[model samples]
Target: MVLDFGFLKTEMMGEIDACCDHGMMIWVDDPWIASFLPFTSREASAEVMQQYRAEVRETGQKLIEGPFGKTLLLSQVPTAENLAKHWFRRLAPRVRLRSGNRADLLSVVVWETPNCMATYHAPDLGRSRPGLSPRHSHSEKFPNEIGGIAGEGGNLGSHERSTFSQRF
Candidate 1:
């Protein structure tokens, strides 16, 4: 099972199969993805915390209606960090399971804030990848990739000067 960084291009069936077959939970910081999940009952919902499924669903739908759905504004920094964290959390537990050491069971706990990005926590892991945002318009491979407008010195452009100021 792969917890990918970018949106998985495949259909929903593949994601469902991953969850059912390998216990792969596809949680995203982006709320637009959440609107599709139905949470009438607790057990089958996508939320890490069962209680918040309905809230998540509503927030996702709102974001979908908002500009984030139409725009390509995705934060590459956050995406990569979350991706690495997901892999680390999943891999460590699988290793522990295979080694017959069940003492250190771990799960990726994601807290999704309504109308905002989600946050996840895992124990004892860190990674650093510099100058790698998809928004770096200078990249020939990722031209015009939107979101996270880092200007001079890798800081965000001045709010007054930035095109995203109004939306942000």
Candidate 2:
């Protein structure tokens, strides 16, 4: 599938108190932005990364100075799922605008860790399910592998296994 990758800086905190306060260096790499423009994937990823870094730096500063302290201020809770949807909403329109409506954004997967992730599929593309396929079956492509490795004999726990199954 057409793919692009980027990063976003965010933080999470309590609704009223600063308990469980922490920052998130979110990574959005799998099934990313696709452009029909002349730029290569490397160039596109670099540009997107640069733009997002600038936004994160500026907005993060504002949020830090605001009443919320260092949290990534949002209307909804800054969970991984919400962050994925947030990035999808922010990027999809730009993709359509830049590609002249030639690109189809299948989904945006936000990785909270190496294994844990949250995916946001394009509803307009008939992606009603969370991790199903509208293009091709991932199982057919990699019949006996998880993350391109033969068998599941790594440090993969149940959560990682489930995530890999849904992703690859």
Candidate 3:
């Protein structure tokens, strides 16, 4: 699983763990972007964060062309000076992919819909939400399940907070 990120907040660790719970392996794309935030102000980070988030997302789609074998996460892409407009439009069609222009921070979770194709494909998947393998049943949990949550979205507590680059 590849988790793309933007100046994501410390609060989102729960979501990540829950997804991992569903038998998914998180890749965590663009971790470097978040790692850079502490040295600068929030305003400065948003521009850099947006551009990187978009770039990472586009990269994720190109690789998901084959059958589903692993849990994937594509974090928020930064759309700075040269945003990947064409690729962005290509991958995300069914979901509303928005970002925080102000850099307040962000998190991920899924809302189930009866006819929602995304859930069928990568139920609870964020970013690409790629189509699922035909052999797998809907009842199967992503390998990274934690209690009831799946696909890296788990019940996060203080121990996890250290992994997050806390923002002021």
TM-score of candidate 2 on Cα atoms, chains taken together: 0.39
Per-residue lDDT of model 3, residues 1-168, tens digit only = 222333232223433333333433323355543442333666766775566457656664211211233343344342321112222233223112322221111112132233221222223333322322223322233322111111211354322211112211
Clash count per candidate: 0, 0, 50
Candidate 2: Cα lDDT at 101: 44
| Stronger candidate by TM-score (1 vs 2) | 2
Among all candidates shown, the one with the greatest lDDT: 2
Name the candidate, 2 or 3, with the larger TM-score value.
2
**Candidate 2 lDDT trough over 10 residues, lowest sum:** 4-13
Please report, as a residue range, the 10-residue window in candidate 3 with the lowest summed lDDT.
144-153
**Model 1 C-alpha lDDT per residue in residues 70-156, reported as the tens digit of each score:** 211122223434533543343434434432431122222222333333223333321212332322212234322212221222244
- Residue 4 lDDT in candidate 3: 32
Given candidate 1, what's the lDDT at residue 41? 47
Against the true structure, whose TM-score is highest?
A: 2
Residue pairs of candidate 2 with colliding backbone atoms = none
Q: Per-residue lDDT for 55-79 in model 2, tens only?
A: 6555431133222333333434567
